[model samples]
Target: MPWPVAAHRSRLLLRGRILLDLRHPGAAIEELREACGILDVEEAADAVRGPALLDLARALRESGAEDGETRRALLRAQRAAGDDPELLLPCLAALAAFHDAAGEAGEADETYERAVLLAPADGALRCQLLTAWGESLLRRASTRDGAGIVDRAEYVLREALKSLPARSAQRGRLQGLVGSALAQRFRHLGFLPDLFESRHLLGQAVRAAADAAVRAEVWLQLGRVRLEGWHHAGAPVLMDALQAYESAEREAQAAHGSDPGSVTAARARHGSGAVLALMGRPGAARSAYTAAREQWQRLVGALREVDWADVELTRRVESEPATGEGRTRAERELRDREEGDWERVAPPWWPWTGEWSNWSEFDRS
Candidate 1:
């Protein structure tokens, strides 16, 4: 950790961080590799090496590099961190996130547990780790064994929220995660209380959200909560749900570029279609579903030219094309509509019911 060498490595790391923030992962990866290379042969550069290696791993992952390299770099960072909690905790968090994204639930849980245990109880790092851990659990909350996981996720995110200030930058995001977890719990347990609480929290998240993308997602979740509440509680929440979906659509359109914006917009349209179907508006529902389908097709067409970095999107496009059986079904539905067969467009076998699962891919925060 010589002063001159440390300063140089610090400059490189800072530049790499800025590049990564700007979405220039390729350039970030190069700068971070150079930073990590600075202390490669130095026996006492462990302090510098840990953070540099972690940044390198992040940049590599963002650049779509091979998973092996990313994992190796993370492991090296942990080793270099030695007994330093400041460095080790971040390494653990990143490693946990990597495991979570790879669907290794067991390993992710273990790593997150270790990080939580090591992080100071009231520290910002603890909140950050819990947020990531909760989000990971939330992502898996739709699986068969989702009941317990979603409940745990709710508790974790709530605890994280307790450590955050009311108007903190991360508060809205934490609230949204908690709301999502509760919403998933309601979906699993059929509890009206959970749905109500989820709607409340998501509303707060929407109001507090600083980023348009975050607001869009919160609004979308709120719409789902409202729709479910309307169905079960028999309240006048249908219009409310439609409003939320429309809000989400606008926010997503304004917040993102072509690729991700199209995906979010499609989800919002599908959500609107669901609400319209529930409102007994068959024609409107059909139109909304058609718009959603078209948007998804457009997204697939755009991504077909490039390698899809999102595995879920790739899976959907490959397995659930709008052509073939899907197109045939659409044509039959259209003919039914043309023949004034509104009854056939009702629930249980409608387009939204049949294809909602495929169209419901959500973005991670």
Candidate 2:
């Protein structure tokens, strides 16, 4: 059999294996590597098959192959394909994903921009690429421009929304991505508009998502938005959010047969605890917080045994909160300050604003 034909056959077989054996991570990784190797051989046969080579590069990256191998594969394909726009977009998108994973934010940003330019009319593609770019910006915001990057992310998401076909499956996914982007922006800017937008979009996502895991994630985001930013209103919103996270967690465990990091269970527990505390349920809050703190501590302890050179692991480590009494004190103080600030500056129509003081007093009575 000719090498090119064999490689094409191998690619097809590997893709089938990937779709059929999603439960086996090891099998998926093996199939991805097989696909990558076949594509490399095909590239040697005909250097101009840019799209095929780019697909191989993306497969390798997704399989957690070595960064150098993935980069070399992509660069060779890009050089072979030259300036073909059809070839460049996937190449750029794959490179963006690789660079972002490798912590090369600047390179990721450049590649993502190129990818967006290549496929400006494809909303779903643009949304996926911009989400990658936005995440990279969020990661390195302190060193190279902050709010501006967030603003750009907001604009990109809005533009992506304009391209979405209403009531379509693609639009549903795009809505979740947009909502997530808006939530991140709110975290950065503390703007009520962003929060409101995020809430609205996330609500849409929850309604549109058919998958339990996806719906759960949308619910988790909505919960975090309310609990963290909306002054802990003691409304039913927090409970609703908790239910969503719990549902997601349960579904993830059943499907994956383990905690698959689906909903960030520890964070959910802590947030639920915080909400409970604010609602004058100290005992339950304490239990929930203790569970979260233990989980976080165990994660930190596990990390301490691993090599810090693992950039992805290092990133996870950086995200873990310090535990014990110190964390409790800090969390309480931060929430108090935020609540006080909101009380002073909240819009008149906002439920927590003092303009509703008489109503609130009556309700308390």
Candidate 3:
């Protein structure tokens, strides 16, 4: 209501923060802007300006506004926070997520790497960054990519897990993400070890997850990995994979029987069809596949928008041959997305212009 000045700075700041948390970024921006306006940075403590500016940047970013003003606000927040790890950690994470949500994977990875380095002992944050980085790498994968990315992603996820305390919530999440990544890697390179490891990790994730939906998804992933393994190797593996898919189907049914057209639900149904087909049950598999196809059509019919950003019209996937990476393929892809056209949006630090992309150059004291 009343303008925020010295006496009411803290209260205004708190209100802005609450609004941001409640996803009312537009309202938060108003309070934050006026509050910050009332106090001069040179006169205000770093604690005050740093956090307030960071929140303002967050407000800006969350409101679907990733303009230069928002970028400058984050940079100012960083400068105000200086070398305070407490302030810097969150600022970096916000910046990284901003990049990630904007589809700027390279920038997100770079920012996350800096955050990881900034807090070497903070396993939780390190695990978070590593997990995000690994995910980005996998998403950047193409048919032209090599197995090294899968290898690197698996390694990174393993390392990410080590950062969390045993059996912690964060640890469980990383385990699930790692499992998903491993499954992807196995699919790419046809590596037995990757499939086995993926199965193990997904098992842990399934056990740890209390939510039926989450566990269902993990079961589906594990089932797919096992099914692929069965395709390449036979006998006991085939049976194991069939069981996994069946388990996934059961979980999916339990989780979302009311929502037959949901992504996970359709995936489960499709996966079950794959299992049926693999087992040479043509009649049953045909029925299952038909059902799955109907579910997919339902999904397409349900799209609220003519062009939903969430749906990819065409998915471009380039994968290496079983033999190895090809010269032309290697040139086009990153060893799991380490390299690409992303350079256009990633030429330099958008915030600092030219003052080093990372926080290493900052003075601690």
Best by TM-score: 1
**Superior candidate under lDDT, 1 versus 2:** 1
What is the overall TM-score of model 1 with all chains considered together? 0.76
lDDT of each: 0.70, 0.54, 0.60
Clashes of each: 0, 0, 5
Q: Write the per-residue lDDT of candidate 3 for residues 1-365, one digit (tens) a residue.
A: 34444558777777988887687999889888877876564367877787777778777876767578788887787787788988887678667766765678778878877887886676555666676666555555422353556676667767777777776755555677678777766656766887778778888888887666666667766776666554445423545755665676676677667343355555555556545444445355456556655665666786622222212211110011121124343332222124323221111110100011122112122
Q: How many angstroms is residue 28 displaced in model 3 relative to the true structure, after the best TM-score fit?
A: 2.3
Model 2 residue runs over 4 Å out of place are: 1-52, 55-63, 120-127, 134-148, 228-263, 293-365
Residues 32-107 of candidate 2 have per-residue lDDT tens digits of: 4565466566554433345445544555554567778778877877676577766666667777777777877678
Q: Give residue 184's error in model 1 in angstroms.
A: 0.6
Which parts of model 1 are misplaced by more than 4 Å?
Answer: 1-22, 28-38, 257-260, 304-365
Worst 10 residues of 1 by lDDT: 351-360
Error of 3 at 200 (Å): 2.5
Cα lDDT of model 1 by residue, 1-365, tens digit: 67898788778888988887787989999888877787685554677677778778887877889989999999999898888887787788888877876779999989988999998987767777777777777777755567778788788879889988666887787788788888888878988889889888988899888988888778877887776675567553578988988898888888865453456667777777656655555567667777766666677776643223332332333233222233344454344445543332221110111011110011011
Global CA lDDT of candidate 2, please? Answer: 0.54
Cα lDDT of candidate 1 equals: 0.70
In candidate 3, which residue ranges exceed 4 Å CA deviation?
A: 1-4, 40-43, 67-69, 120-123, 141-148, 235-243, 249-257, 293-365
